[model samples]
Target: MGQVGTKDRFELVGTPPDHQEAEFADAVREGLSASPRHVPARFLYDARGSELFEQICTLPEYYPTRAEREILEDRADEIAAAIDREPTLVEFGSGSAEKTRHVIEALIARHGHLRYAPIDISRAALEASADGLLADHPELEMVGVWGEYARGLLTLERVTDSPLLVLWLGSSIGNLTHTEALAFLRDVRERLAPQDRLLIGVDLVKDPAVLEAAYDDAQGVTAAFTLNLIARIARELGGDLRPEDFCYRSRWNPDEERIESHLEVVRAHTAHIPGAKLEVAFEVGDRIHTEYAHKYTPKSFAALAADAGFAVERNWTDGEARFRSCLLAPR
Candidate 1:
């Protein structure tokens, strides 16, 4: 654990991810040993994967990023106005903080002064974005947390006196399973006061074709993003994975009600990682489950939030209703 320091307008707290490589090795061993090979999506966001995702966001079929921005562009001020008390903006998975500028501007405009606390896994990305943001917004001060979301959030009360506006945007919650999401939100609820608010982005249920295309694009960028996970295993962890043997796949699992991302074995292959002590075998039909993006209707999301002890204060959507930005107050 590292102590929070305040020497600059935008300061980074928490320790660097010295344990990530060890965790990745452990995860690879665990995931590959399972019956259906699986890998956690978080591991896919290494430096290269993060860059590819930024490109994925710009794709025509990928609507979450564009949809979220539309809502913020139209209603950010209204969202900001709901919090009468001056509040600090805190974001989880606050990558480049590209789409976040909308809400940041609104908060600064309404409050005259604003503080942003961005929590992320990458210290370099956080610092780079922090510098860029500070340069753009002179009134904005920042406190960055370069580790997990929970650690970043717990430090807020000690760092700033203002009420906290926690932003879990970009449909991040949708990445978790129902049980996981509930438990995660409950943990977050435990850390917040009744007056503190959380704003979340929820992707709405849409046409199956639309969902599938968003993940498996015509240009094959999404495919590269999926392959990068296996590529990462080989590149970083001394795994002998023939990335060419695995092909990217996306499907709408109607029974499960989610879009599934996978790497299907195009040809039978085996991978061995000395670092993780794993030797995984694959057949032509074998699949490596990489990610799941669940879509929610408003009713479904609100019910889940209520169970986690939050009340929906506001819900904003794009023109096509492709996504939702929900404001939640502690119940």
Candidate 2:
């Protein structure tokens, strides 16, 4: 029901928080110096790199996309009605904003007005999504909060009205360490007006095979996606990383209940990070751990939100029940 009209020029308005770039650089430096297999999950999304990831979602083994899409296709209206009224749609780490359209469309069907805001570290992504969404739904006024999710929360004061619905979709929240996730949601709860709500997508715990396949698809797209982080560093600060020197590995960490991605060194070598003036050594087969995707259960996710001052109000699942979309309200 979102108004479709002539496309308007979309503006990309923001960049990473100044300190973020510095911190990211430092993390990379420290990570490189510490071990052969250390890489940050965040560096995986440069312009071209991000496009590769969208391709990753369509690979047959990637279940989150298909699972979440099924839930939206079947239950978007039910999901929309769970929220009480018209609200600004604010999405954290909004990415290309594809999944968001489902709920946004449903919201507009029930309520004639909407303001769409997406927060992402990549200005290119935000602008691209805003332009597409604006063109498709002229009734939805799009805004981009161009910063890391936590810092972007600082800009929430710019939105007004009650029952604001903030979205944290695509199982991206799984990237955070448990402690970090709790602290972040707590900060978000503190910033909310009383009637505000949060809708988050979670990848559910499943068979080890299914979990492993999602990250380490047979097509190797996910592997290529992981290695691109190295290419990103090479281009960013003039670092020279031989992409072939590192290989991607994804494995289930049963003890931690997560899937971990690592970059393993194929040979002993040294790489130069020009900006940091650092020569980092790598041992053959040593792994620089990059990311962990923690799968969640209904109880665990609800508990995590509750600990952060939220009450789970509704839950939506796909036909396969492989993923979950949770709607929570401020306590």
Best by TM-score: 1
Query: Could you list the CA RMSD of all candidates, in the order they appear?
Result: 3.0, 2.8
Q: Least lDDT summed over 10 consecutive residues: which range in candidate 1?
A: 1-10
> What does candidate 2's lDDT look like per residue over 20-107, in tens digits?
5676678788877773447567777767778888999899999899898888778888877876878778898888888888988998
Candidate 1 residue runs with Cα over 4 Å from true position = 1-7, 155-157
Q: How many residue pairs clash (N, CA or C atoms closer than 3 angstroms) in each of the candidate models, in the order given?
A: 0, 4
- Residue-level lDDT tens digits of model 1 in 20-50: 7888899999998997889988888888888
lDDT of 2: 0.81
Q: What is the TM-score of each predicted model, taking all chains together? A: 0.95, 0.93
Candidate 2: TM-score?
A: 0.93
Candidate number of the best lDDT: 1
Question: Pairs clashing in candidate 2?
Answer: 37-287, 37-288, 37-289, 38-288
Colliding residue pairs in candidate 1: none
